[model samples]
Target: MYSDYHVHTNYSDDSTYLMEDVIKDAIKMKMDEICFTDHVDYGIKKDWDEGPIEYLYGQPQVNVDYPKYFKEIESLRKKYPKITIRQGMEFGVQVHTIPRYQKLYEQYDFDFIILSIHQVNDQEFWTQDYQKEKSQQEYIEGYYQEMLNVVKKYKNYSVLGHLDLMTRYDEIGNYPFEKVKSIITEILKTVIQDGKGIEINTSSHRYGLKDSTPSRDILKLYKELGGKIITIGSDSHKPEHLGAYIDEAKELLKEIGFDSFCTFEKMKPIFHQL
Candidate 1:
């Protein structure tokens, strides 16, 4: 089945594409299913008194309006009967934000949730400010350390989104995978042990990277470690980007010795043959 699990819509503060437009585009592409994994990041600003700020790619990053979001999803589900639309969220996890996210999960019924580390100690990695004071090694290592901490503390997610996401914004260019392999192994092992999975984020090509997020080496390592739960996503924020490079991502996983990827229903994994 053709599916793109990681997608953003106008509900996410960073995206401008409307939800209906994204669904229509996926339908036109002949996708069997698509999930709206909109962003819901906490700790963007220290004080609630401060107004919205441009924290993500120069866009004002705000938390997802859950009530309105789910209501619209229900509307689209009936509006588009031919394709399956799943309710999902890309939760930017941090140690301090775990409690808030836990409450969110308890309140809503999500088909899937992608645990991601977008900020370390409230400092966004996409901006150079976070990297300014640390050496390249320190920055990369710190990112993984935060990821390890989150996986250890939180077990409410379906998969870890873009396991090596820091690479996309690393100003020093590629840090040797060997430099962080040990911690990454621990992170992956922890996720797998917790019944969680990882996603092959196809946005790497769109961002001018030569490989997908987490890279081929990481994917191979996960397979070697008996990590079977995998999902492929375009990480699309626009209509034109929907389902982009998903076939290539699936092929890459197959090359890495994975026979199938995954889909989710009510937070449980459903395997699909490649």
Candidate 2:
């Protein structure tokens, strides 16, 4: 079984799964470990006064309630001793949000952190509103350019989450990888130099994507660039999705010349043989 490092619970505005239920389900599925990496995007655009809203169009602007989040996880830790439960956060880092994230790092003791780029200039790429403004090449370049900036500025994260996440929401279908290869290479180089890594987000398969985020070609490039640190995650938000396709992700890593995958404790990488 694989350790699912990217997961969400009720603490995240988007998810409804209670933390305890997530733990119970992970145990039932025979997972070795699980981490709660709920959403923490600082500048998410939403009408907070409004009650419930749709995600594809209007994103909920919310942050994790750190005290309650950690408190519940600690209780779950003692309650479920057999499985390792790690405390983590998926930080949606924009160039402007770096200072806020720095404060968050200092305020909490997280076992892991997955730095992700969900939006740029406070505009979410998932929505058609943002996508309509730019051409395919323009949007793709803009996404990677923002990511490169974030990677260059932030060093406290364990790995980059869904490195090519824009592809999942691209209405125009696949963008030519060659167009962004040079910039992607630069981003990977920065991450490796900072001793950071990337995750193989298995949710791509669930989303009917043809390849994993940061596809096999990008994974191969990372390996060739001497970037060895890699982790696998389901990016699961519900009980049914827990540990989904994790074994297949590991096998994919092995085929790409990665003999092992990584886990984290106190933000330090630990390799596990595949």
Candidate 3:
């Protein structure tokens, strides 16, 4: 039940946390399980062996080194038998990147895959490259529309990571949820119908947000719409962030009327009582 489903290691370009060190930290935190959901944004990042690598924001911008990543995970499992480790990757999928993700899914025996929209049309949100020029409605609509399209075409993921992720990068403050209610409803409906779930990312607390990553409103809507599967993650990239606010998140879910939360193994969900 105490599982951190979203974590990053040195394999992800933006992280420098060693995989072994992450395992040790999880064990110390009394975490029952942890998954290595490192980044793999094909449209924006290159695979480790895919020719010459380039640097971005102080690190070599490269996807997971598949061979080393899997090898180390296997090694760590045996070395740290007290804590369960699962293999996963965060695919920052865009509409055009679906094919690449599908190929990756076929190549690896992943326990989980977080389908995230870190960027759309190869432009990143954190950098404001995707939202700078477009009007608020245009960019908001564009973001959700791209997500809807991605969910419609992509089926390899276990859950949608940080459903309202754009809010994190939005410098304009909270955009009215009612304004994009219809599209959000469509996106959630598609996810529910496809048997996928969403995660309540606790990183919102670290970011000092007004609510959880998806916001309480979205979580309630998902419940009202008959969506069952949900997972909670700290989205940790550092030791201090590991397993952060997980208990608080579970409390929040209980407040929202969710009696159970999920963990994945071989891409199948296992529910635990809240």
Predicted candidate 2 versus true structure: per-residue lDDT over 188-257, tens digit per residue: 9999999999999999988999987779999999999999888888988888788999989988988889
Q: What is the lDDT of candidate 3?
A: 0.92
User: Model 2, which residues run further than 4 Å from truth?
Assistant: 45-59
- Candidate 1 weakest lDDT stretch, 10 residues: 45-54
Q: What's the lDDT for residue 266 in model 3?
A: 97
The TM-score of candidate 1 is 0.95
> Which candidate has the highest lDDT of all?
3
Question: Residue 102's C-alpha lDDT in candidate 2?
Answer: 95
- Number of the top-ranking candidate, with TM-score as the measure: 3
Q: State the lDDT at 45 in candidate 2.
A: 35
Q: Rate the local accuracy (lDDT) of all candidates.
A: 0.89, 0.88, 0.92
The residue-by-residue lDDT of candidate 1 on 104-129, one tens digit each, is 89999999999999998888887776
Q: Which residue pairs does candidate 2 place in steric collision?
A: none
Lowest summed lDDT over 10 consecutive residues: which window, candidate 2?
Answer: 45-54
Query: Mind giving the per-residue lDDT tens digits that candidate 3 earns over 134-253?
Result: 988888889999999999999999999999998888888889999988998999999999999999999999898898889899999999999999998999888889999999999999
Prediction-by-prediction clash tally: 0, 0, 0
